[model samples]
Target: MTRHPTEHPQFYLTAPAACPYLEGKQERKVFTHLIGKHAPTLNDVLTHGGFRRSQNIAYRPACEDCRACVSVRVCVAEFKWTKSLKRQWKLGQDILGARLPTSPSSEQYDLFKSYLATRHENGGMTDMSVLDYAMMIEDTHVDTMVLEYRSKGPDSFITGIGQGPLLGVALTDQLCDGLSMVYSFYDPDFDGIGLGTYMILDHIVRAQKLGLPYVYLGYWVDGSPKMTYKVRFKPQEHLGPDGWAKVD
Candidate 1:
């Protein structure tokens, strides 16, 4: 009898497209669907192999020439914040993040629209509609969550939830050994508190409290100014041919 390996997923590659992080370059991606009961396990394995999760798909850059997209994960146990990072954390103490269900809301959609308009005007997600946003949140099969950040309420310590206008949101995945940050967006108009930096710092603290050793920060592209912030959370490992190794 002949049998096919249904447990193993098939991967497909996309046609080359303009590289978002670099000019005069093209990029392609190899991707597979994560589905069924084995999704969480599959996600963990693929993540450690330098692939990133998006909704229900796992993908990694497969450029023919450029090798600039490097996966990064912070060593949470050994993470040490610089004075600047500390300041940013302290300034944003009023904000709290709580893991909420993947249900989409009008408020979230409004903020998401504003963020895309201001921060990613010409980017791929610029045209995302509310239904698309809903799909992004609800289409996942792995162990995923939506961490919504807002002003801490009087009962925040007891409830582990926040109140007030939403400030930031991170779509994260809980892996066996770490938390993989799938994607994050924040209020671009909010000033002084460093909302972007605070969300990451909070994730590290959450990982530490949960006894997770790493906080995956997604791909870090060399020469991408936007990606430079990922390196600031020092004592991080970059995935390379030799596997994960300290780069900072």
Candidate 2:
């Protein structure tokens, strides 16, 4: 049975929890399930309205007293590579990223565990098990892909695929106007390679090739060092009460 895109979804609000980005603040989220035949279209519409996808759910910040988590999207047509970004891009030249079906693998889960232990040991995802990681990758109802970055192999030039160890992974959603990056993690040992930044740059290039206008970067908090990186991409638009407004 086909579901109509015009059908309204039932939204729910999450209980207040400690804010991850801001200290001493509580955070809440208003979310709805993304499922059925209209999932892709609904995901696109909700994303345009500042919602982000996670597994089978679409959510946006609904904090009581704070609006720090602002949705940001890179203007692909206007993005320019700075010297630092160019260097970062070059640094990852030995890495090959390929978009694959959202299938869970023990290899990817191992990498995820290592990344959380090294980078986000104290975060909410620290306790995630292999099953949990699998759910994160496979529970999506909308159009999704897992981009796996690995060290380039000898046959990479001919096959156009990476080999050996996984360097990074990005769980992304395909939207009508852009690619929404759901979550990304990298091998902490390659921190100097700036895998995270390189992934974003690659996404922008991919978006440009596909003639997409934006690359949804989830949210950017003003004072959160963890999220400050999102702002470095120039010509980005931030969602506000007036809708998406261009940020200098």
Candidate 3:
């Protein structure tokens, strides 16, 4: 059934489960479905309010006693390329990323499997089958796209597409004010090349070119080494009680 764009959506909370970022603690989330004609607008609003999209649901951490997860977004207009970031950018100069419609391909699934095996073997998504991966990419109502990165080929300048094996992929959403990075993974063999950071930097540039002012980086949890990288982007804003405030 279709709902009005201004209609208040019902929110549900998930039961507490083992916290992925913090060991020995539990985490819960408040989520709502993104569907119908208003899904895109609703996604924009929820994203600005600190929620992140996964599949057709928008959610945020609602842990009882922990507030470690802070939503962050890069202030793209004010972002400066540091020397280190410049080096990383040069390292990935041969790679070209293209934004494609939210569709699944066997090649993407193969890369996803390899990424999970090498980087997150013991994580929750390690056992995901091809069907599950397809659903993750296709079961979306908002303006979602997959940014596929590959080595620039001979025809890249003409066709705007690379012609080699996929090196990285980012599931992203385009909102009214920014580009939200839902999830991203890269080839583990290219770990030292910093493909993950390269993707974020690329997104910031993409956002700036589109006249967008932000690039949402999802939740950056304190004390989580894995999540620490999210803070590397300077002049970022963190969602707080007073809404998005500059993080120094």
lDDT of 2 by residue, 1-248 (tens): 86654377999999999998899999999999898888999999999999999898999999878988899999999998889999999998889999899998988888889999998889999989888999999998888999999989999899878999888899999899999999999898976678889999989988999999999999999889999889889999999999999997
lDDT of 2 at 199: 95
lDDT of 3 by residue, 32-116 (tens): 9998888899999999999999898999999999999999999999997899999999998899999898888988888888888
Once superposed on the true structure, which residue ranges of model 1 sit more than 4 Å away at CA?
1-6
Q: After superposition on all CA atoms, how large is the RMSD of candidate 2?
A: 1.7
Off by over 4 Å in 2: 1-6
| TM-score of each model, paired residue for residue | 0.96, 0.96, 0.96
Give the clash count for each candidate.
0, 0, 0
CA lDDT of 136 in candidate 2?
Answer: 96
So what's the TM-score on candidate 1? Answer: 0.96
Clashes of 1: 0
**Candidate 1 global lDDT:** 0.91
lDDT of 2 at 104: 86
Per-model lDDT: 0.91, 0.91, 0.91
